[model samples]
Target: MDDILKLVEEYIKEKDSKKTWVAGEDWVQYAGPYFTHEEYVRAVKTLLNGWLVLGAEANKFETKFPPLLGKELGLFVNSGSSANLLMLLALTSKRGRNLPKGTKVITPVAGFPTTINPIFQIGFEPVFVDIELDTLNLDLDAVEKACQEHPDAKVITFAHVLGNPPNMDRLMEIVKKYDLILLEDCCDALGSTYDGKKLGSFGEMASCSFYPAHHITTGEGGFVAVKDEQTERIVRSFREWGRGCYCIGKQNLLEKGSCGTRFNCWIPSLPDHVFDHKYVYEEIGYNMKPIELQASLGLVQMEKLEEIGLKRRENYRSLFKAFSKYPEFFHLHTAQPKSDPDWFAFPVTIKDGAPFKRSDICQFFESKMIQTRPYFAGNIMLQPAYEGLHDKDEVISKFPIAHKVTTDTFFLGTSPVINKEKTDYIEYILDCFVAAIRI
Candidate 1:
């Protein structure tokens, strides 16, 4: 086994080193995973161990990943979407905050569907609001306005746009003033920080992704982060089939149990309505746990978190500089003050009256073998699935910035893959577009 593992490690190094970029031949993806030989080795070792469920590897990951976000505990789930649902659902748990049904969750109009979908799924009332054009984050001014208009709103949920959070100082002030719960979606802002604290730390509950396109990759995984153990257990209950049992990893499989009182939640003779902890249903939840294999892969990915964040920021600056050269044609992303963003992708909005259309520049990028993505699910109200979701006919017109984003905003690769070579290539592409528009 040792000899075979050594061979595997050497092969991974050889294969990984061979990857390279070509000016017009390789498609530079907007985001992707960066894995090393350590990841490969750990994955293989875990596979060999044959304990394939969420056990030791998952346990290690929960402990290791959250501290960077200033959290002491977390619950691993199948995806970032599930992480959102887990945390939001956990808020209703008797053991947790125990907020009432129909709690109002204020969110940005422009964001991925999963963030909003969970609100409806959990029967929470969603109040959609606009985002800042420059930051593509929820407009806190609009949020304060929403709070004034809908004073009953109890929670605020929104993504840190492309890993750049809105002004945290102002956001916290709004949270405090309105007495609202912050359910932040840190899916894009894994290593980002506001006021020297991680993006996920300020919120009551936060969700993070581990998709290949995210800062880390576990094939398909995410986690719900929390500041306290009780919230952790509440979220854990939702993730683990809503069981009351809090046992993690090998503890579940222990012969007498970690508590040394196996199956003691119930006594059959006593009519006291007792039941085994594992069989006790707590919350109405779906199965959303990720496997041990995914956790093993994530463990290795966290080792490169700091370095990955540095490269992403460097790439974002280069991209921002390149686009800033065409200020008349673009509205480049402006990050929040006192915040450090390890940008997921550098988003840009085509100026409303720019000479060239978004399609024009998108075509140029495609020709150069550069990949681009539309800002995620902009104006989700316009989507077919949510046709009847909103009752107000004026809802679509209320958030003009989100509508503009749907038509005008796009993003380019800011992953570590966008090195000096990619930056130069992108500048050349932009220059060609500018020249064409001038002609």
Candidate 2:
């Protein structure tokens, strides 16, 4: 056992050492997983234990993660996309007043597909809102207008775009005025806060991603953080195949269930015989639970968040400073007045009258092997998948900002992997591109 442990330690060191960004050869990766030996070891240890499904690691991660973002509880899922779906589905469950079918949900059109997809998937209509070019978040006035125009709007779901938080002060006021439910997609906003409070904590429930590009990595894992136990149960119900049993972690058959009703319950809907609560299906659910290995890695990833988050912030600032002088050509990102963001990336948009086009600059970055990505499905409503589904009135593409994003916006990496050296290189290349275009 001692020799085996030594081998694992050695394997981690050798692999971790090779992960550095090697300037010219390696692409200044748009984003990559920030992980180390600790995460690797934990993942390996969990896999070796052979408890492949949800178990101790998942339990610890779920419990430990929520507090960092001020959430009281969390539910782990296979991916952030799945987390979004489950979060919305949970709201439409009993805990969320079982929002009636065809209820209107106000959300931005300029966001990841899953953030808006789940609304439609759960049979709710999304009243599209335009995003602000500066913050790349929902336009608050448009949101209020949508709410007043459509008095039936019961839910507001949106992401903290590229880690830039919206005006939460006014957002919450609107929420209160309308008695609307809030679901934050914090996939890009982990470690970010508005008015000193964490982004995820402000909403009824928030979803986070641990995909390679996010603030942290658990390979392909995500979690839904809830404000209370009832919401947590609703999220878990959807994640754990609609089962009503609440026993988390590794369960021992000999031990009584967490609720102490494992075998003692009588289901009114079931035939007159007593049934184990574990086998009972409460809501139609899917198998969205993540494996224990990912959860084990997530525990280690959570610890490195602070250090990694600092680098991301630094990278964003450096990029912003570099581009500030070129505002006419580029409209760089801005955070809400009260937001102190732990940014996901350094987003930049080519101004309408820029000498060159968005493609021109992005191609230049690609040629240099420094990766750039278009803002996640800019104007997602225009994407092929959403083509015929949205009616002319259902989506508000009339506001040109979202459509402009589709043509003008793109982002560069601000992940921990982007250090001073890479950021300098990015600036140097941007300078060259602009210089070339000027001639």
Candidate 3:
């Protein structure tokens, strides 16, 4: 087994060595996973261990992940979408100070569906607010206005767009003034910080993605991290099928149990003095737990978090410099002075009177095999699925910026996979395309 494992590791390394980032006709992916040979080996080892469910690897990843984002606890889930759902559901748990049904949640109009879907899924009214064109984040001024109009709003949930931190100073003020529960979707802003503190750490709870296109890859995985023990327990309950059991893995330990109630816990509704904790259902939840294999891969990917962040920042800067020369034709994504963003992609918005449209440039890029994608579901409210989900009165502010985003904004590859050759190709294509438009 040892010899075979060594050979497998060597094979992975050889395969990795053959990969390169030279510019060519092949597709330049908008996003791709960065995995070292070690990650492959760890995955194989976990597979051999046969603990396929959310076991030791999941526990270790959950335990070690919180500190990276300056949080107290982590709950692994199948995807970032599930993490978002779990986080929202936890806040509505019967065990916690549940926000009453139909409570208003303040969210941005321009964002991915999952960010706001969970609010509606969990029976909360979503009050949409506009985004700032420059930062591609919630315009806090608009957010404050919406909050004032809807004084009953009880929660604020939003994403750090393309890993660019929002105006944390003003956002925190609004959060405090309204006394709202804050949940940051840190899926894109994994390593981003506002005022020197991590974005995820600022919110009461946060969600992170481990998808291939995100900062890290576990094939398909994510986590919901919290700052308090009780919240952690609630999140854990939701991720693990709403079980009352707080045991790490199972309730088979000889000593007191993981939660100190292994064999001793009374149920008010039950006739039994001490029912098994594993079977206790505390709240309505779902089976969203991730497997050990995904956790094993995530553990290895976690080791490169800082390195990936640095590379992403480097790529973003180079892309920014390249695009800055075309300010008249583009609206480049911006970061506040207090923000330290590890950008996920280099977003470009065609100016209102630009000779070309987003489709024009994106089509040209696609023809050259340089991938581009629209901002994820720009103006999610405009999406067909939302036809009847919201009331007309729920929109307190106009989504002019969001409407512009849907038509003007698109993003290019700034992933670590983009090397100098690819960047040069990108710049060359942009120059040619712009010159053509000028003609």
The whole-model lDDT of each prediction reads: 0.86, 0.87, 0.85
lDDT agreement of model 1 with the native: 0.86
Worst 10 residues of 2 by lDDT: 390-399
Q: Candidate 3: where is the Cα deviation over 4 Å?
A: 20-22, 390-397
Tell me the tens digit of each residue's lDDT in model 3 across 191-244.
888888987998889999988999988999888989878888888778777887
What is the TM-score of each predicted model, taking all chains together?
Answer: 0.96, 0.96, 0.96
Candidate 3: clashing pairs of residues: none
Per-residue lDDT of model 2, residues 213-282, tens digit only: 9999888989899988888888888888898888876564536688776785457766577788888877
Backbone clash total for model 3 is: 0
Model 2 clash number = 0
Question: Model 3: how far is 214 from its true place, Å?
Answer: 0.5
Candidate 3 lDDT for residue 429: 86
Name the Cα RMSD for model 1. Answer: 1.9
Q: Write the per-residue lDDT of candidate 1 for residues 215-265, one digit (tens) a residue.
A: 988989998889887788778777777776777777888776665665564
